[model samples]
Target: MAALPTVQAPGIVNLSYAFTNEGNLLYREDSLNYQKEVFAYDELNRLTGWDIYDDSSIPNEEHSIV
Candidate 1:
């Protein structure tokens, strides 16, 4: 019998999520790509804005929802 080579599986995703006490998504991050997403809500728990950060880039992208 011959030994075979071992290979790592592809398409593996390393994601993390966070939520508020009210069960609203607050943050999400991808550890593999060093990307992060932050969410903001208003007093009524409505989405107001969000920001996405890429560690590979100099400027972070931010978006405001109306």
Candidate 2:
């Protein structure tokens, strides 16, 4: 099985990520640090969008897609 990728949310709430813009992350956030949203991926396991949520088990503003 493939190992899980690391997720991160390193910034203040309602504020943009210190490193990059949020739009590039493919989801609008009410709070980048606190908002509950999940990463949406394609069948090939590539990120295609986001599942905006009021609650989620995930947190992160950006992803390092390689």
Candidate 3:
């Protein structure tokens, strides 16, 4: 797969990645270098849950997407 593109960073990711083994996205960091979001997948390599940075400003609080 192609590498994640570098954007002008519209309050979003400047750098990001996907795990090669499962091809699952790991995380995305903003230009400020703070982890903006994170991800997790199931045994079937399907996306299970993720964390969102809200007004609380917390990081990686487990929450299911489905």
| Residue 40 displacement in candidate 3 (angstroms) | 0.5
Go through the candidates in order and give each one's C-alpha lDDT.
0.75, 0.44, 0.64
Window of ten residues with lowest summed lDDT in model 2: 15-24
Give per-residue CA lDDT, model 2, range 1-66, as digits (tens). 232233445563353322112223334445644464445555565667655454465444444344
lDDT of each residue in 1-66, candidate 1, tens digit only: 222222233457677777787767788877777788889999999999988988754439988999
Model 2, stretches more than 4 Å misplaced? 1-34, 54-66
Off by over 4 Å in 3: 5-13, 33-35, 53-62
lDDT of 3 at 24: 72
Q: Candidate 1 local accuracy as lDDT?
A: 0.75
TM-scores, one per candidate: 0.75, 0.28, 0.56
lDDT of 3 by residue, 1-66 (tens): 566644555665466455546667776555556555678887888888888653346755668867
Clashing pairs in 3: none
